[model samples]
Target: MLYKVLEVPGIEYIVLDFKSSDGNFIAQDLDDSETWNAKAFYQWLIDEVLVFTDDGISGMDKDLYKQFKAFANQRGVCVCDSRKI
Candidate 1:
């Protein structure tokens, strides 16, 4: 499987592209994207956009967190997480 993150003009949220089971490409807004095989768009957000600690503890990089919060607020999107709900 492959994943891609995209930004479309006139859209409030980011966009995502991935392959479906039928080998067709599907596009959806970030908040509405699906998770398959434990891989999701939020993983890209965490790995690329946000700074997080991976030492088996629930810790955040304060400065990066602040920046991310501001960015999310400005864009009207939620912060990165495994589950959006």
Candidate 2:
């Protein structure tokens, strides 16, 4: 797993790249190119990038996503899937 923090003038976001024998998982904001905070970034990462199925399944690794959620929570960011509600 490799990650990078992108910081610009007024925007900041983290890009997480996880590689495994199955495939590569890259977490980022896919809908929009701009991000402002960890909350929004993680929210979008889960909602848009992960794109959970109706059965609550995503292509990403479950453990990795769990770690991402924990990291976001530590930073006061809610990475809950809005579409599930």
Report residue 46 deviation for candidate 2 (angstroms): 2.5
Residue 14 of model 2 has an lDDT of 51
The sequence of per-residue lDDT tens digits that candidate 2 reaches over residues 11-82 is 244554445343334455445654335455555555555555553335545666566667767656676666
Clashes of 1: 0
Evaluate model 1: give its TM-score.
Answer: 0.29
Model 1 over residues 1-85: C-alpha lDDT tens digits? 1121121112345433434564333335567664322133334454454333433113443554566455444444455553333
RMSD of each: 12.6, 10.5
Candidate 2: regions farther than 4 A off: 1-33, 53-57
Indicate which candidate wins on TM-score. 2
